[model samples]
Target: MAGKLDRFEKLINSLSTWLNWVAGVGLVTMLALIVADIIGAKLFKWPIPGGIEMVGFLGVVVATFAIAQTQFLHGHIEVEFVVTKLPKTAQKVISCLTYSLGMALFALLSWQSFEFGRTLQTSGEVSMTQEIPFYPLAYSMGFCCIVVFLVLLVQCIMTMIRAKK
Candidate 1:
């Protein structure tokens, strides 16, 4: 059981690393697009259509997809004042509980986001500027949320296991 769990952790870590890289690429692309748009508007006097909307979408993708990596790196915000003073066992328990709640919240958000995306897709919703379909991007956000939730769940379980030991 321990070996299996260890293997699962490794798999999740690998997947998170790949996702982090993808998110980094997305961030860079978004930055480049924004800079180009700015330069075009300021210097060339020609702004790209729907540039803001595109950047917004890319930003969401970058942020959401990077969540797992952030958690894996312990980069998420932590109010550690009390936690840091607690006993090791208590700290582990609190960490497990915190992550469990986070998992639940993200799961709920993913479900609602998916439903919203489906409704938009069914209604053929499009962005105001370029008439770009918004549903696919929304659904992708939901998918990223799901990935983050799964990563949190794995972390929660791992913490529980460690607490036992």
Candidate 2:
């Protein structure tokens, strides 16, 4: 079971790494677009059309898509002073609980985001400036949420197993 869990962890880490790379690309693209828009607006007295909208979309991509990788890396902030003082088993229990809570929250977020995306799709909702469809980005958010939720669920399971041992 440990071996299986480790292999699953490796697979999830690989997928999260790929998502992080894609998020990096999105960030770079957003930066380039913003720079170009600034230059065009200031120097050429003509702003790049839909530049803001494009950057906004890319920002969502960069932020949402990196969440799974960030969780995998344990990059999020933690207040460990109290947890560290607890016995090892207690700490593991607390960790499991925390991860369970996180999984639940993200799962809810994923479901709600998917529903919102569907609503947007049905309504033909779009950005005012670029007329860019909103559903795709919402769907991306939902996907990312699922990825994070899966990561947390795995962590919760691992913690429970460790606590038992």
Candidate 3:
């Protein structure tokens, strides 16, 4: 059982890392697009079409896609100033509880995102400038949220095992 969990953890970690890379690429692309748009507008008196809309979409991608890996790295801010002072058992209990809450929150977000994506798809919603379908971006948000939820679930289970020991 432990071995299986370990394997699963590794798999999730790898996926998170890959997603992080994708986020990095998205960030860079967004930056380039902004710069190019500015240069075109200033120098050539012609701005990139749909540039603002693309940036907005890329912003969402960069933000949502990076969260899972951040969770996996335990990189999110935490007020451990108080938690660290607790006894070992209490600390483990708190960790478990924290991860449990995170899992729940992200699970809800994931479900809602997917539902919103489906609604967008059914309604044929699209972006104003590019006319790009909104559903794919919504679906991607849902995917990222699920990844974060899984990361939290693994942390919660690990904390439980430690508490048991």
Best by lDDT: 3
Local accuracy of candidate 1 as per-residue lDDT tens digits, 1-165: 879878877887788888889889999999899999999999999999999998988887788788888987779889999899989999998998899899899999899989999999999999899898989877877887777787887888888887887
The Cα local distance difference test for each model comes to 0.86, 0.92, 0.94
Poorest stretch of ten by lDDT in candidate 2: 153-162
- Candidate 2 residue lDDT tens string, 101-147: 89889999999999999999999999998899999999999999999
Native-to-model Cα distance after best TM-score fit, residue 38 in candidate 3, in Å:
0.5
Give candidate 3's error at residue 39 in angstroms.
Answer: 0.5
Q: Which scores higher on lDDT, 2 or 3?
A: 3
Candidate 3 C-alpha lDDT tens digits along 1-165? 999999999999999999999999999999999999999999999999999999999999999999999999889999999989999998998898899889889999999999999999999999998999999999999999999999999988988987888
TM-score of each: 0.91, 0.96, 0.97
Better of 2 and 3 by TM-score: 3
TM-score, predicted candidate 2 vs. hidden true structure: 0.96
Task: Give the higher-lDDT candidate: 1 or 2.
Answer: 2
Using TM-score, rank the candidates from best to worst. Answer: 3, 2, 1
For candidate 3, which ten residues in a row score worst on lDDT?
Answer: 156-165
Pairs of residues clashing in candidate 3: none
Clashes of 3: 0
